[model samples]
Target: MTFNITTKNLDTFKSAFIAALLAYIFVYGFELTHFTLSIDEEPLDNFLQTLSAGRWGHALLRHYVLPEPYAPFFTTALSIIILSLSAATSSIYIGLNKLQSISFVIMLAALPQLAYQLEFSNQADTVSLSFLLSVVALFMIEKMSVIRASAFIMLTVVSLSVYQSIFLYAATLTCIRITTDAIKGQIIFRQALKKIFVFSLLITLSLIINSFLAKWTALYFDVTISNYLTSMIGWGKRDVYEVLKSVLIFMRDYLTFKSAYGINAFPFVLLSLITIIILSIKRKRGAPLIILMGFATLLSGFLLNFAIGSGMPPRAMTQIPLVFAGLFAAALVISRVRYIGLIISIIFLCIGSAASNKLFYSDFMAREADQNLSNQIITTIYNNIPNFDEKVTPVFFYGSYSPLNSWKIPSADVFGSSFFDWDGGNNRRMYMYLSTANLIKLKEPNEIQVKNSIVAAKDMPSWPNRNSIKIFDGVVVVKLSDKLSPYNR
Candidate 1:
């Protein structure tokens, strides 16, 4: 079987229209709100300020700003434009019909977790991922030319500079593209191996260039690049065993707690496997290589997690589903039962889109209620607390509070909204908001410099982590009784 590259013009207008419509519906219908201030916003805000102040060098190499360089506005918008163009080009290379491409774009635009990332996650990893995909799409679709190859290298460097985790995506896309090509007989096993070898070298080259670029850019800006890059290059306190353990845990979570994410990939991977098996039975020459490449693609995410040594939220994790979508499109184009493949792709996509919409809508309403309550309580506290800016307040929260209680109905995700949910993880921030003063966490008896304040919920007589309600040493202990506003309710 000889693989012939077929040229088909995708209805770019239809794809873009559907993508835009779905985006609008989700943004409006779900009321997905972006917060002005969040856990991750502080550094981004600082970076923006630095850029505005012409301290571009300091912004990228600022203290406590690690994990990636900060070039938000330019990188983000450029990435989005590149991604859109990449999608359009992919439709032609993969021989996707207008409907198929539209569905793919809709999934890209509407997946709830990805939507959450775009709305919240500070756009660093997400936009970097977009850049990585664009690199893959452009490289795969365009005929190899000196200029084109150089452009791919440049984009690849930019993608890596933005986020080191992009190596995971770069590897995943390369595997899928190579496997898809082999399955389509566009390349034999030898050619597929050569492509993989060349892609690996490109990634290595990109990593080296990005490091020099990061240091060079920092020097140009008169900033210092921290030793954090050492860890990013897979050298840190976490040993290989520890990293492997974390990766295993992450994999387990993906199959259970994060299974909805895996839904998009698992089915498509299975279909690809079955397709390869059938083709192998028919004496196909490159089926085994396709199988190997497909497995490599599946494991790429885990390897990335190990390298990062932490579990990332949906924003970064969405790369897996996107890779799965690309593989599905490639497989659909080449399958004998193309209609059946398309139907499965459509069904999986519809499920993912519906789940994403429902997840966000429920989270949106919860956030609205939480925000209102938070504002009211903070304002009330502000009104009552004296010397609000000059004192220290230690808060002990009573009563079990959960975001699930804020929803009008049972919320779509049991995990709760990332930004709105106030659990043990964020109790300190909420307390700071409530007190409007300096916060001091009391582990044991300690001397108070400023006025010591204590706050408890309405039903706080019996709660874990409770401090004594009795006033002592001129500490102003305030109990938010039932007589005050209904905060605990």
Candidate 2:
């Protein structure tokens, strides 16, 4: 009997894995095969050379999975495999039936946030592994023995260390399990409350431990924790009431498609929720609990936003997709009209896949435009600057380039942004791009030289003008724009 059960589990995992793999291939085949570069990946040529920036778990995983010089195909393929494994594990742990399991993996693969995360292909596998660990930790939380609890904490800590945003993913999963089990009559309301309390306490403990470990890791690496992560939380930075209001407003915007990317999942989420509610009411078991938990599941997507007292990028809002997947799964399990649920899931998958294709195609076009502009600037600099030696001439970029390209396709965040226009990293990105392309080895200007170039660039013309590419104080200053704001400088 044990062997038979093991075989069944393996078969379930295999089925889910195949479903997820096919879904991702349909959505991201172009990105997997094509050499695509996003703003962040432009300067991130060597993965190991980069600092951990408080993401020690991601750093460690990248050390093993991604070494040096980004390989688009390899990184993308590995990411797909890891994410498919995560989907399979989730399906097995959640006790999803065959149809629901297929729906779950399909929705997971079609998530827009996953597409955005893959934009930074160098660390995509690490992020995917973090996601897998988050799901695994939640799955382990179901039994809640001493050993399992310890494993849960360890997994949660590692997941957060790799990528903090996935904590919301785990939290949403926990809420989904509690709510769904209660509604399905698998667990009483009292049992649901107890599980919630236990899971919350363990998750809180894991977070505290993660915080301490992060601080220790920073010290050990001789690196100061980046304020980007630390400052995201609004413990003392925001008023309590103000933060609450902002979080609610942000959630409303996100759900209503006011603040979303590509194809919005709001319609599908609403349909799934309605289906679940109607099915639960018909059964008349834990109907009130189902309604309350349904709301909780919806709110779980923005739990991190509530904690941080602000909004986040599309990649950070991964829980939204997870929420959609859970709702669809719940509806599938309870509804007599399983075909309706399956059809909705398939439609969502097709829409999301189409959007993913358009997004990648736009990104490819943007990269081409950026490369053309870079080449033009390089040629102009070499021709205009008398005896310009790239090895010796210190190059400083003042301001940023905003090319007129078709890449601006209504993205909710940084997905469509160009490397040349990435604020505060224009010079580094350009230098790395040139070096990686073997076009030139431009010398990077020091702090003082950069400051001087900024000051001198105020009087110079922007790009396409004769005075845009000029030598200022023995440093080549390429003023891509006239507005030299301190933020971009």
Candidate 3:
């Protein structure tokens, strides 16, 4: 097919418009409902605060991923960059033709699980993934028009400066890998290896540019030296076949249903993708596209899980489908399917999932109410102290501790949300470990003082450890330990 600029532009516009609708809906819904953003606002606030203070790298070094001089360099720099770009690109896409614009826009919205992250982190994650996707998108553009050299360079530079650094780099490499690898038998194996080596050099060059921009911040705290090292040792090697099966299960279970989340996200995306994959293989051999999309989705989860999480982190796990589906849509037309079978199937599944989730939202609201109650109880307890520190502190529980050295305080959430780096792993580990470790960390000094003060007041119950949780039906508020008197009683 020869080029048809007029029709192509229309496609771009439509795709961008769809992207904007979903992004805005997701963002506003959470804000209106007043659900906590999954990730804390404090980190970005802190980083921006650092920027305000005339220290560009310091904020990223100290708090971007893990306050470094501790954790590896600004590995998450790629994510942060992509997220901001996605947000910015949202507007740029609006004026574009329906297909081009909507394809980019929708892909931005779907990639990186920004909607889900927004429920907790607001728009920060969205910004990061946006940039990462832009890189992939631009790379495709480059294939058609090498004149886009400047644009590609600019996007790559921006990608290195933020948090999506690892996945962006890894995905790019995987794309190059799959492309060169596909022809190994067709081309001489030696020649294919030579092409791969050239791409490998290109990947390294990209990372070097990143190092120059971010000063190789990840190098500051070597992974070998960090505490997450203990975790890496525990999690074993990767097998590609196992990853693919897991990917299949992830699709069918989570994504098809409207309210599907994490482990439940796979069905809608995979079912749809399968249709495209068949088309790609038979007619277009868009295998490279599929491989890269799959790599981005799956590799993002794996890299984040190993580097930051325990294992099988749901939030991290969820991003695979979003990124894959968007890219898959770009290569095919779901609406063009003979009749409307494909589109209808996806819609039916989404609605079904939404129905099952109605009851969950009510409980979610109640969870909010319980959190409010627990806050009041904790505040009341705080007043008994003769001395008070205006600054807040994180309190962990159950004798667990943080990986980094933190200012000694009454409460320090070592592994909790703000501090958690787990890309995607068991949610419980993040909460439980941080809560318990912080309390254990605090109890060493404040236990006797806190206990004596409470006993003298004759209002509070005896604590089992220096920490305890003020529990509601849906939320757990970790506070002083009280085995003898449960907060509910």
Best by lDDT: 2
Tens-digit per-residue lDDT, 300-326, candidate 2: 888888777887777778787788888
Model 1, span 1-489: residue lDDT tens: 222443334245446544534443443243233222323342324554333333333345443443333343433343344455544444444444666566555444433444444433345334535444544534532455667667767767655555555556656666656766666667777876666676677667767876676666666656565554344443366687776677687677664544543243343454655665576547557767766776676677566666667655555564665555655655554464544654665565566656655554555565555566555444444455544332454433323333333433332223234332344224334443333222232222233412232232333442112331333343333342223222322
Q: Please give each candidate's TM-score.
A: 0.67, 0.93, 0.51
Tens-digit lDDT track of model 3 for 1-489: 122336554455344444545543442333334333223332323444323322233445446444332211132233333443453343232222244344434333433243333333323443345345544434433233444544454455444444333334334333323332332212333544454454345545555675454433433432111232244332344465554555445433444543223223434456544664565466544455544444444344344444432343333343453344343343334223332433442443344334223322433443344344334434543543323232333222222112222322121111122222233222233343323323211222144443433343233332322224332221223333333222112
Report the poorest 10 consecutive residues by lDDT, candidate 3: 407-416
Error of 2 at 115 (Å): 1.1
Ranking by lDDT: 2, 1, 3
The candidate 2 region of ten consecutive residues with least summed lDDT is 43-52
Better of 1 and 2 by lDDT: 2
Give the Cα lDDT of each candidate: 0.49, 0.77, 0.37
- CA lDDT, candidate 3, residue 439: 22
Q: After superposition, which runs of candidate 3 have C-alpha atoms over 4 Å from their true positions?
A: 1-11, 22-28, 32-39, 42-45, 48-112, 120-126, 129-133, 136-154, 169-201, 211-263, 277-312, 317-319, 327-371, 374-479, 482-489
Best by TM-score: 2
- What is the Cα-based lDDT of residue 154 in candidate 3? 46
**Segments of candidate 1 deviating more than 4 angstroms:** 1-7, 10-84, 93-113, 124-129, 136-149, 216-246, 252-268, 306-311, 379-489
